[model samples]
Target: MEYNEFITHVQTLTQSDSREEAERATLAILKTINELVPDEEMQEIAVQLPQKLGEILREKETKSNQSFNLQEFIERASQKENIKPTTTAIHARAVFSVLQSSITPDVFTKFHKYFSHDYEELFFTSP
Candidate 1:
């Protein structure tokens, strides 16, 4: 799903009348983000994401009809953290790593297709 859709889902899942539920939802989102990004990248990105996501949820709560500003969120996240803004590349690597570490060889062929040329280009271009 797109970030906007994912955020909407998260917001819905998180908005409980209770503070405890909200906290739990935040933790779940953080876990998902950690699982999705490289471990090294997580610390930097995590510093900014929870607050950003909370802002998004707050906006949705106050202005029920307003459309979510997903592009702005992405732009802000990348700029604030000095991280690459490509979700596909990040998620592809995360899923590939998870499959590699846990799944059997029979599933490798299915998971392998998710790997992207962007990562290869990134690897080659790095100093």
Candidate 2:
């Protein structure tokens, strides 16, 4: 799927009243996306993924960090010609890509599926 579409998908899958549930769902999606894409592209995406995901996952804590504003960081990074805007899906794909590089593809696949399944459970179980 395209970047925007993927972000929308993640948003849908992650909708929850509880921030903890949303964060877990987002992390699951990120792990899956990381397993499915390529290395170079993953590295590019990684520049923004951790921060963006961190924001959604750690809303209050991240705010207090002073240096954890992913959106602002992305905006500044985008000012450079080489850096692309970090969309939700792009961040997911980047995470997968980085994982692919760091771990064996087989392990990544297993972990991705496991996380995806766990997120699905959380998404459904949430009130």
Candidate 3:
């Protein structure tokens, strides 16, 4: 999807009042993923997304840090998105939902494999 369409979907899914809010939330999740997944794996997923989103995923240069769990993931994203921890999961679901729909199944699978079973909960929540 194009960047605008991607952001619009995020906004619609999260019911954010402004595109900017959705964009920030989306980037927060993407950036978190960038930090969690290895650079090569992240690059694989990034190329499949819109240019802007891809760039966001590639913004970080460090190696992946997979030590953290789901709660820490939520906390990091909440802080980055500037949203409450209570609502971060919903926003994160919106971001991942948009990602699942936008990319090829293969690419999504590659991205999904990086997260453990616990992270699967984010996928089921209402966006």
Top candidate by TM-score = 3
Query: Would you estimate the TM-scores of all the predictions?
Result: 0.28, 0.31, 0.91
- Candidate 3 has its poorest 10 consecutive residues by lDDT at 60-69
Each candidate: what lDDT? 0.35, 0.39, 0.85
lDDT, candidate 2, 23-114, per-residue tens? 44445544333333344334444444345542332322112222323344334333421334544434343334443444455544444343
What lDDT, from 0 to 1, does candidate 2 have? 0.39
Maximum-lDDT candidate: 3
Model 1 alpha-carbon drift over 4 Å, by segment = 1-14, 49-127
Q: Between 2 and 3, whose lDDT is larger?
A: 3
Residue 79, model 3: lDDT of: 86
Model 1 steric clash pairs: none
> What is the TM-score (0 to 1) of candidate 1?
0.28
What does the lDDT read for residue 87 in candidate 2? 45
Predicted candidate 3 versus true structure: per-residue lDDT over 1-127, tens digit per residue: 8999999999999888999889899989898888798888888878888998998888884457565788999998888988898788888888889999888888878878888888987774445
Candidate 3 error regions (>4 Å): 124-127
Q: Give per-candidate clash totals.
A: 0, 4, 0
